[model samples]
Target chain A: MRLRCLALILFSLSSSLARTQPDIANPHSEDTNWLNQYAHGLGEQHTELGLEALQLGDYAKAERSLLDAIQVIKVNQGLYATDQLRPLQYLIEAQLTLGEWHAAETQIEYFQWINVRNYRNSIFTYLNGTEALSGLLLASSANVNNPYSVRHLVAAKNLNWQAVNAIEQTFGSNSLELAPWLYRIVLNHYYQSTMLRRQGLSNYSFKSDSSEIVSGWTMRHNETLEMSYRIGKELLGRIQELFAYHVADHEQISNDATALMTIYQGDWELLFGNDEEALEHYRSAYQDLLQMGRSEAQVDRFFDRPVSLPAPRLQMQWPDQLAAESNEPLQFFAWSPMYPSASRPAEPRGDALAADDQQTALARFDLTPAAEDEPADTILADTNLSLDNLQILGTTPDNELTREQARVYISLLQFRPRLVSGMPVKLENIELEYLFPPQMSLLPLLDP
Target chain B: MIRSVGAYLKIRGTEMFKAIFALLSILLLHACVGSPAQSNAPRLPTDAEVEQYNASVPADEHIVCRDEIPVGTNIPRRKCRYVRDIQQTSTFHREQLRRALQ
Candidate 1:
C-alpha cells in the first residue's frame, strides 16, 4: 500500500507540472505570432456570431459572444486597443436592448476610455470614435425605458461640443470641417429645447449628479429656452460663415452651400417661432439660389415639399440631391419622444420592424402658408396645419388609443411651408404616412 | 544775491540734493506699486486649445469652454474651466448653503 501511494503521488506531481507548462516561463516554449493570429481569428469569429445573434434578436447570446470577443481582443492587443471598440459597441447595443442599463453604462464607460486613449494617438481615429459614440449615446437617449435619458442626451451634446473643439483646434476655427460638428450642436440644442418643453417647470432648480443627488442652481425654463435659441442661432451662423469661406476659397463654387445654409437658418428660426425672420431668411435664400444660376423651376421644385424643421441631415448643396418627384406617400418616422427632429439611427436598435407589426397612419392636411400679417412670434402655435382628415390606414393590434396617439404626434410636428417664387404657398391634400416607433407599438403613447 | 562763491555753491548743492531726493522718491514709489503683479501662470488657452487639452484628458478632467459675459460688461468673453473644478465649486457652495441652513 505504501509503494502504491508513492507511485500515485509521483503521477499527481507530473500531471501538475504538465498543467503549469504555460506559466513555467520558458522563453522559447511559446509562439507569440501564432497566439496573436489565433486570438484575432477567435475575436473576429465571436464578433460575427454576436452580430448575427443581435440581428436575430438573441440579445443574451449576442452579449455573451461580444464579451468573449472583447476578452480575446484585449488579451492579444492589450487593453485600450482600438480593435475592441467594435465588439464593445455591439455588447453595449445588446445590453441596452436587454434593458441591462447598468451593464450598458459600464461598457459605454470602457468604450469612452479606449476612445480617449486613441484620441491622444490619432485625431482621425478619435473623430471616428466620437461619431460612433455619439450615435450610441443618441440611441440610448432615445430609448423610452432609459430613466437617465436626459443625462444621456446632455452627455451626447457635450461630446459633440468636445469634438467641435478638437476639430476647430486641429483644422483652424474657420475650417469647413467645423460645419458638421456645429450643425450637430445646433441639432442638439433643438432636442434640448424640446426636452425642456416636455419636462415643464418643477425640475428646473436642480442639476443631475453622476453618483449622488446634488442640488444645484439651473436656468429656468424660459431662460434655458432662450439660451438654446441663442446658441443654436450662433452655431448656425458659424456654419454659414464656414461655408461662405469655403465658397470663397474654392473660387465661388456656385454658392450652393451658402444658400442651403441660409435655408437651414430659416428652418432654425421657424423652429423657435420667429416667423418673420424665418420668412425673410427663406426668401433671401431662394433669391440667392436663383442668383447662383439655378433655374426658378428647379429652385421652386426643391422647396416644393413641406420639410420638417431641423432637417434630419444637413444639406450643403442643392439640385445634386434633389429627390425624383414620386407619387408615393411622404413617410415620416418618429425618432424619439425626446428628440422629434433627430433622424433615425442608420442601424436601428432592437428587433427589426416587421411588416406584420407595422403601425402606420395616413393623414391629409392642408399645409397653410404663414399669413403675411400674422404676428412675428406666435411661438409653437400650429396655425399652419389645417387638418382635413386623419385616418388610421393600418395598425397592428389595432386600437382607438393607437390611432389617437398617432394623431396627436402627427399634429405636434412643425413643417416648413412649401415656397414657390420666393413666396410661401399653401399645399393641399398632402398625404403623409406616419410610422410609430417600434417600442411604442402596444403601449399607450404619452405626449412627447 | 552776489555774496561769496562758497555760499552760492552750498545753495546750489542743497537744491540739487532736494531734486535728487524727489526723483528717488518717485522711483521708489513706482517700484513699490509694481506693475500690477505680473503673473507667473501661463497665458490662458484659446477655446480651441482648451478643447484639444480636453480631448486628451479623461472626461472628469475635461474643460467646459464658453463665452461668458462679465458683470457690468456688454461684451461676452470666452471662458474655460475644468469640469472637475466647476463640480467642486458647486459642491462647495451647496455645502455652505446646507451649513448655513443648519
Candidate 2:
C-alpha cells in the first residue's frame, strides 16, 4: 500500500512538471524550433497582408509590412533564404510605387545575391529566380524616374546571358530550352539599337561603375546598327535550328513550329529596317503554311491584324489556335523610351508599369497602309503608318496635356502591316489606348 | 673493312633520334607561330559568345567588335578591341591635341 502511494505521488509530480516546464518533461520540445515555426508563420501572415495592402493602393503600409516579413523570414530561415524572394519582390513593387528608386535598386541587388545562392541547388529554382529578377529589372529600367535606367537594362540583358550559359551547361549547346532566352537577348539588341540613335547616349555605359562607353568609339553609328542586325539575325537562326532539331527527333512534331519561327525571323528583320529581307521571309512563311495544307482563309485570318514588330511572345504555331478577335481597344503600353516594342511579362507582381497608377489616353486613328502605292518597293517599310485621321478620345484624368501627349504618342507608333493574301493592306478605324509611364516629364520622347 | 654490328646499330639509333628531334622542333615552331585569332577565336563571335566572354571580364575590359574599312580598302574588316585600350588611346590623342593648341 505504501509503494502504490509513492508511485502515485511521483506521477503527480511529473504531470505538474510537464505543465510548468514542458522541456523537462519532453526533451525534444526546444524553444528554438517552436520560435522558428512561429516566426515563419508570422512572416507569411505579414506577406499576405502586405500584398493585400498593395492591391488596395496603400503602398507605404505595404512596404512596411513586406519589410517586416522579410526581416522575420531572414531571421528564422537564415539570411539568403530563397523563401524570402517573393516578399522581397513585393517590397520592391511597393517601393517603386512610392517613388523610392534608390531603395528599390538596393533591394534588387539583394534579391540577385540571394537568388545566386540557390542557383546550384536546382535548375527550376534558378530559372524561377532569373525570370522574376529579369522582369523586375526590365520594369525598373522602363520607369522614367529611374536615374540608372540604362544600367538596369544592361543588367537585365546580362542576366539573360547568365541564364543562357546555365541552360547550355545543364542541357546542351542546341537544347530547345534556349529559344526564349536567346529571343530575349535579341529583343535587348533591338532596345540597345534605339538608344544608339540618341546623340548624347554615345557615352552611355552599360556597367554601373564605369563611365566609359560600352562599345567605346570602335563602333560607328552605322556599324553599330549593323552589329544589332547581325546578332539578332544569328540568334533567330539559332532558334530555328533548335526547333528543327526537335522536329527531326520526333515524327509527330509538326513543321508549323519552323514556319512560325520563320515569321519571327521576318519580324526581326523588320525591326532592323531590312524591309526587303523581312518581306521575303514573310512570303516564304506564307508559302510554307500553304504547302502544309492550311486553308488560305485560315492563314489570312492569322495575319489579319497588325501587331507591333518583334512580337512579345515567340509563338510556334502557324495558325494560333487559341487566338480570338476582340472588340476591345488595342492597348499599346510602351515599356520604355528605348524599348518601344518590349512588353511587360504576363505576371503582374513584378510589373512597375502596373504599379505606377499612371494615366491612360484613348485615341482613334486609321491604320492605312502607306505602301498602297508602289506596294512592291515599300513592302514592310519602317514608315508604314502615315499618321492620318488621328483623334484623341479621352484621357483618364481628362486633361488637355495628356490628350496632346496621347496624340503625339499615337502618331509616333509603327505597326507591322496587316497582310491579306500575302500582301500588306490597309485597316480602318483602329482604336488604341496608351498608358503614359509615370515621371514621363523627366525624359524626352525620342524623335520620329 | 665493315664495322661491328653493335657500332652500326648505335649510329642508326643516333640518326633516328636526330630525325625525330628535328621533326618535333618543326612542329613546335609551327604551333608557336600560329595566330590565336585564326586558331582559337571565331571570326566574328556570336552574340552569346561575346556576352559570355564579356561577363567573365570587367567593365573597362569589355571587348567590342565592329566592321571597319581600312584606309586604302573598300572592303570591311572585323576589328575588336578592349574598351580600356580604346579609352587610353583616346585620352592620349586628346592630350596631344590640347598640348598642340597650347
- The numbered model that scores best in DockQ is 2
Give stretches of model 2 more than 4 Å off.
A1-38, A198-200, A206-218, A251-253, A318-329, A334-400, A433-448, B1-42, B88-102
lDDT of 2 at A257: 85
Indicate the residue-level lDDT of B78 in model 2. Answer: 65
Q: How good is the docking of model 2, by CAPRI class?
A: incorrect
Tens-digit lDDT track of model 1 for A351-391: 66676776767776656634655442222223443343455
Per-residue C-alpha lDDT of model 2 across residues A48-103, encoded as one tens digit per residue:
98999888778999999999899889888888788899999889878876779889
**Model 2 clashes, total count:** 0
Model 1: fnat (fraction of native contacts)? 0.11
- Evaluated at residue B11, the lDDT of candidate 2 is 94
What C-alpha lDDT values do all the predictions have? Answer: 0.73, 0.73
Measured on C-alpha atoms, candidate 1 has an lDDT of: 0.73
Query: Model 1 clash pairs?
Result: none
Give the least accurate 10-residue stretch of model 1 chain A, judged by summed lDDT: A201-210
